[model samples]
Target chain A: MTDLNRRHVLGLAAAGLASTVFSPLSAFADEKELVIGGSIPLTGVFAFAGVAIEAGISDFVKITNEAGGVAGRKLRLAYEDTAYKVDQSVAVFNKLTTQNDIHLYYGDSTGFAKTINEELNRRGSILMAGASFGSELNNPEKYPFQFMAGPDYVEMIAILLEYIAKQQKGAKIVFVNSDTEFGRDPIEASVKRAKEMGLEVVGQIVTPPTAVDVSTEILKLRRANPDFTIFHGYVLAPLPEFLSQAKQLGLKSRFMGTFWSMDNSLWANVGAPADGYMGVMPYRYYYDTAPDAPILEKIRKLRPTYQATGYMQGFLTAMLMTEAAKRTLDAGKDLTAKNLKAALNTIKDFDTGGIIGVPISIPGNSVPVGRIYSYSAADKQMKPASDWISLKK
Target chain B: MRIATAKETYIADEGLLTTRTQRAWMIVLALVLVLAPFVLNAYWLYLACLVAINVASATGLNILTGYTGLVSLGQAAFMAVGAYAVAFLDGHLGTPFLLNIFAAGLVAAAVGVLVGVPSLRVKGLYLAIATIAASFILHFVFTNWVSVTGGMSGVNVAPARLFGIELASPFALYFVIVPITALMVLAAANLFRTRIGRAFIAIRDRDISAEVLGIPLLQYKLMSFALSSFYAGVAGGMWAYFFRVVTPESFPFATSIFFLAAVIVGGLGTILGPILGAAFMTLVPELLKYVVEWLGPVFPNAGAALSPVRTIVFGALIIFFLVFEPQGLAEIVRRIRRFFHLWPFKT
Candidate 1:
């Protein structure tokens, strides 16, 4: 052998390092295993929802495996943190898909869902669901391989509007939304729907997502002085400020919100100010003691604490994905996007063991179902105020 | 080892590759660029395409901030203009993608000229703030211009088609994006050899002195902005093709800061700086992912616990580079090349 020089050693070490890092880590994957890949936003702005979503998916995977995974195949979850960035999310997507035979995917944001939709169609293998309830992704013709766990943003707003219509005839309404894609998603559609329902829309207040002070917006809200104010797009923040300021102004308008802002624990922190605040919730609350909910009991036993609405969303998403896969396998078919999506649509009035409070069906890319819940300060919980409302009906 | 060489002509002295070794290395680099798509996997090809687009944009930012002494935070806005232009042309007119990209560059250049008018009055941080305001205005236009920009939903661009073949996959897009990036970088390198480029450098060194030398400040400043934003617009067109969708949220303010940071970290005012800086910045986060994965056995929830650490580490690395290698990665590369040139001999 030739003499071992320093340069040769360094070159060899670099080669070894590259090989170790780039080699396929999934080479040892079992044939009886199915992968559920995710681009999770475990860090950055959406970390709160991301953390809970990760846990919910992980817990579902574990529970399914323990009970013998769908069609004798074990379930595996491979995920990376995206920091809620579109490019980073795409990178995570490319990395995970390259390493695994993933048939199901979970995306973090609307931007991600849109960016990856073309790639999903090109692959023709993977079906996806995401944290985004953007109304744009609810089209079956455009996005055949993608679905959301519950109602799209517009449908959520529609559910709330229906509730308002039932409570009062031609109630004057105002919309307060963040100036974001998510916030603006339901506005135009909900406005039209509210008009169709004979409710008068008085004003629309748009605020920046990061606005700390809503003094000007409050002035606008005071001017409108509608019977009801519906807030969308934000998880927390300015809502509390809006609530407190609206109270100080002694405005008679009842405040409301949609899916992302309806969590009981979130409003509980706001105390009395959040009391009587209402919104549309697609899934049952964690502490929901309804007689039909076996899933809630299982969840409570697994973790003795209140899970966020995001957790319910994630859990329901996993359930729907698994059910689709199971139905595809049961029909002795390959898990191609077409077959799996067809199987998903076949889910008519499927029972969720109390997760959804009522049997849910998937007519298209969305469930289009929700119930209005009001937050009570004394109990610090979102008590159900309306029966389960399905837009499909 | 090369000791010294005497040049007989100015052309010889100013040559991009004066030494024989450099010419040989250039050939080798060409070969590697050609062979890379074949050898790299799908994920790496995706990253390569992304890096090429970033390099193009960062090179544009470097032209403005590093060479022309004009700080801008509107690179992303310019890119958005290009992306939207391409999206509209491709979606509405069904024109060829190359034509769409060229049109995108022109539109962005026009906007850049408008935005650059303030650079004549304010500079440094003030100029940067002005650019920031411009970006916010552009963002508002993109958000509210419902008829043209598709409002908040944004527009989806179809895959670039060449000879009826769709360039959808990373492997296919690699051919289109890489060559365009290479040509843009080459054009930037050649720019400094011209009178306009020299004027930019002169303005960067001292505007009053440059004015004394009879170089018109407004003309040169606007030209520099146009050229820089043209480069950015072309890159954004490539980005639109690569991502196949362009939303208002796609090119946020943070991305502008990202390109600026890349220029500083890659060694500003150098031909090779932006390329090195963009590649280094892009790969660092990806490398950290591997590092986190490697530590998984030792720490089960390392993904959650160390995920935030990756951001911290990224910040720390930037700081470390700023403090230690103030001139950036290009200087380090020069030192290594110089050491190799005079190997076995003490400098």
Candidate 2:
């Protein structure tokens, strides 16, 4: 060959060799592995929740692998940081759908979940189990591919409102929420339910997501002095501030929140003041009484950083995912997204043991309608307040 | 002696790939863009539509940052303005898609002019801060102005349609976004060859000199702001229409940073650079995702570590390009062609 031709051949060979060496994992990725992608916001504002969710997923994958995995094959979960940005989330979703054999997606936030639902509806390849309990996620008619790990936001709020109404006899409630979809859905639904139940909604205040000081809003609530305060918001850093401010304002009324406020860290920051805070969750984290509760113990043993409350709830979510995977395998079907969705729909009365008091199902448009858990500031524990309550569809 | 050789080489650097090649490439791009839907899958069409929108936004940003030497991180806010504008018009008046999009752009341009009023005095980091604050203020309005902007729940936008044909499909939207993007890019590219364009270049190099030459500095600055915001507004309209929804969460502060990063990494001050930058910023993370997916098993703790590493690598890559390849990939391609033409001669 001429020198130029020989040089071109050599360069091509070198490029090929480099790609093969650097991307050796790509070769093995094609072999018998079910890649389930988790699109979480690992970098941005919601990084804390994203980390907790991923930790739950990681621990679950580890447990499954140790127990011989699903259908005698190992399970892999990959995560991409959407940074809580829709464009970035869309990019991650595209990467998961186009490049990988990602049958399932998890950990997308509320807005992102809505966007992903629209995309998944377009190409019916991926089914999702996500951290978001937005009412949209539970709309089986709209998003057939999406299944929630917990009660819908509306259900959770209704349950909390109902619990408060029972406790206070005729409690005056105020709904304070960030103006995000995560905060608005529950308040909107619960307020209507509260009116229906003859519980007075004294005041409603909507604050911005980046409100560093919610003192004004707190003052408004304090002035109203509602018997119960339902904080339907995701205030990771500012939650403690809100609680402390409310305490300073001498609002002795009870404070409560949706699932995101169930974290111990939120309570730990405010101390004794956060004592009366209650949150509605799908499962009981500190429960030790059920027969099939070994998974809870196993999770605590493996992930020591995982406390009993939100971590266990997230772990139960992952456990539910594994059980659904097992059901898919039992049907002798390929672990495709469609088959997984089918398997999940067939998940009727899945008893999560003592971890969750009630048996949960996914087939219907209904949520499991979880119970209320009150946080004890002195003990730093979340305990179940009532039995699981089902609501009207 | 080396300087002499370099100076001598500059005369011979001109190649056959001039205006003809440029026009030829544009024609090829137009054809490929026209036929892209027929060849690529649904997902890719979606991605392409996004790319076109980014291209439109970046083109406007390129005019400000690349042509006029300004740094602003409020492009996303402009997009929000355009998107909300489209949503508002469509919801209230039942306006058609094309008219609404243009109206949205016009509104954004108006906002851009309002923001640029401070630019009459502010410069450098001060100007950047002003623009950054403008973005936050815009977000505040969107989040707090519930009656108009729908607060955080976001207004569900109506799809863009023409001649009774709904622009609902990704392919249909692609045709809408791509052609406008092409027109904007071509317009911007050709604009640089005009007096106002040269005036922009002059201002970019040294504002004092341009002002001395009577380029009407304030007028041109406001024009830059108006033009840049118009592009962002159009992109935002596309975003709302294509996604079939609009929420405050869709346009976060990070989006502005993403645009700035795309411009910087793609090749600041060049038309091709923003496109290259947008593609890099968009595609690199995607490529990293597959890489992480494939290598996820190698380390059981891969999920925990891969994302941070990708970000660190992204930062490092940007720095590397800025330091080692300041002219960007476009310049690198130019250098390679130069090298090939000058083959058989030693440096």
How does each model score on TM-score?
A: 0.97, 0.83
Which whole-number lDDT from 0 to 100 does residue A53 have in model 2? 71
Each prediction's RMSD to truth: 2.4, 5.5
Model 2, B193-261: lDDT tens digits are 679889988999999999999999999999999999999998898888987678887887778888988
**Which 10-residue window of candidate 1 chain B scores lowest in summed lDDT?**
B338-347
For candidate 1, what is the DockQ? 0.69
> TM-score of model 2, chain A?
0.86
- Distance (Å) between predicted and true CA of A329, model 1? 0.7
A95: Cα error in model 2, Å? 2.5
Each model's C-alpha lDDT?
A: 0.92, 0.76
